[model samples]
Target: MTESQPHLLFSFGTLLDRQVQTALFGRTVATTPAALAGYATRPLAITDEAVIATSGQDVHLTLERRLGSTVEGAVLRLTDEELAAADAYEVADYARRQVLLTSGETAWAYLDANPLRSAARIVIVGDSIAYGRCDPQGGWTGHLAAAHIAANETQNRVFNLAVPGSTLADVSAQTPALLPPRHPDTLIVAAGINDSAVPLAAPGDGHDGLAHLTGHLDSLAATARRHNARLVVVGPVWLDETRTGDYEGLRFTTDRALALRTALRAWCADHHIDFLDLWEPLRDQPHLLVDGLHPDAAGHKELHRHLDALG
Candidate 1:
């Protein structure tokens, strides 16, 4: 017989019930005994009628963080499609996250969902584009912050620490704000455009520029891991060279932007972090760029829509 694909899931609740398993997966799944350390189980009231009917229970066990505690469970190997079914079976009261088991295995487990209950702080650091220079609505970050406030999630904080014309090094300097008691739950970086801008009279290829930006990104990723925060890298936007060419001592070209965007995408993939690519999406829409550089209000709105979709 062929072995199941490697989508390990650790379950300690209704998923263990034979009937529930059959109802959800159309068959009883084989499971190996396992235990999740550093967590305890608590009752989570389920109000979803469909979920309650499928699980045949109104209350289910949910995982909660507690030092020195462990929740006994079983590991079930599932295919990607089966995993999606499991996700569908889970209620909104739970959020899935990867965890290390006492058996020296890593698996996905559902825990109590708390983003709505506990306000999450998001910190954005970048340059003029991230700072909403040309947009009256304060760019995409500003739109995100405003939406949170308008939704009555007052405790949910969004900090935009972008500086106009800042490069990767300058943004790296701004990461100090992510330390200690004010550590953000998420960090969003919207940079690279400024770094891609080369002096019109500069010599040699821009290989050094790519390396420098990527190195800073590596450091930022390490910092996010240390703080147990999620890191998202936003790629550079397309520039209209007709209006921006040689305006200053520096030159902004589409080729440089494409190179940086590709680099950012690859780095994010290798590091298993989130990346938002804005090049192709905004390239054809020259009207979005107010001054052939910064995005206008409508463009900012478009950016916000994409970012929000990431969730």
Candidate 2:
């Protein structure tokens, strides 16, 4: 729609933030709280950052009728100039499309487009952090979503398929059955911390440390290439230093976390995948975390900055 087209822009998550809205969309657009249907939002833990998700994890994704339960959000009505500016901001990851409102009428708006629908799907597959745990905003999922929303005002659907405590074996087990037959436009994998926590001496270990991590990452890259999706490998967030419980009968420390990050980065660079060293900026910011495991409010803010840097 043209800037003067009297458009309705649907906003969720950080875009819901008044300050963030004013900063990005300008003051001319009128925003009314609104929601979309068939989805619930959750947080992903990756340092302290604001990210959210509508799918994946233990959260039951509600697949109601196209006119089912509504997600509350702001309906931004903007002048042509404001809309144009908003479009520029959102052209990275989202696109404008008409959606069936709860009333069964089509309202022109923006939504995530399935990469397969146009180019290829870019999938984010990982564990609790990738699924968003601490920030309650789905961590990078929220960042990716907001950025996607801003980057691709033309509409591109991004999918996050991560589960808490998910092991490399879990992904391997599910890939054949759950993954789409085709590759995605991009594939991001954030995992291995929980798996590494398992004591190496344990019998019947679920993941084999570097070997497992390397294998799984390789598999992910192969799958992405098969589907023609850009592959990105994200490093794990550090453990909550305050919470020291026996993980697989072993102790965890910052050194261990840093080692993991190093390994993952090496693998990504070696494999020629897009790597986001999410840990470097915030790994030292332990105070930004919640319960030593997830990112606190400050952490989420820092994460947003990192994501912005990637852009």
> lDDT score, residue 112, model 1?
57
- Residues 1-311 of candidate 1 have per-residue lDDT tens digits of 98766798999988888898888888999999999765677787889998999988898988654445678889988787778888899987776655667876767787655422222567788999999998888998799888865656644667888898888887877686655465565678888888888877764655456668777998887676555455678898888878777746778888888898998999887765667777765677889988788889998888877766644
lDDT of 2 by residue, 1-311 (tens): 64345666666645455665566555434566665554333332222122222111221211111112356666776666666665554433444544434444334454342222232235677887777777666676766666665655544456778888787667656654445642344566777776566463663655446556777777766665444344566776656666745654655566667777888888766654556767766776668777666676567667667766653
Least lDDT summed over 10 consecutive residues: which range in candidate 1? 111-120
Worst-scoring 10-residue span by lDDT in model 2: 58-67
| Clashing pairs for predicted structure model 1, backbone only | none
Kindly provide the TM-score of model 2 when superposed on the true structure, using C-alpha atoms.
0.55
What is the alpha-carbon lDDT of model 2 when measured against the actual structure? Answer: 0.57
Which residue segments of model 2 deviate by more than 4 Å?
1-121, 181-183, 200-208, 240-242, 247-251
Residue 235 local lDDT, model 1? 91
TM-scores of the candidates are 0.65, 0.55
Clash totals, every prediction: 0, 61
Candidate with best TM-score: 1
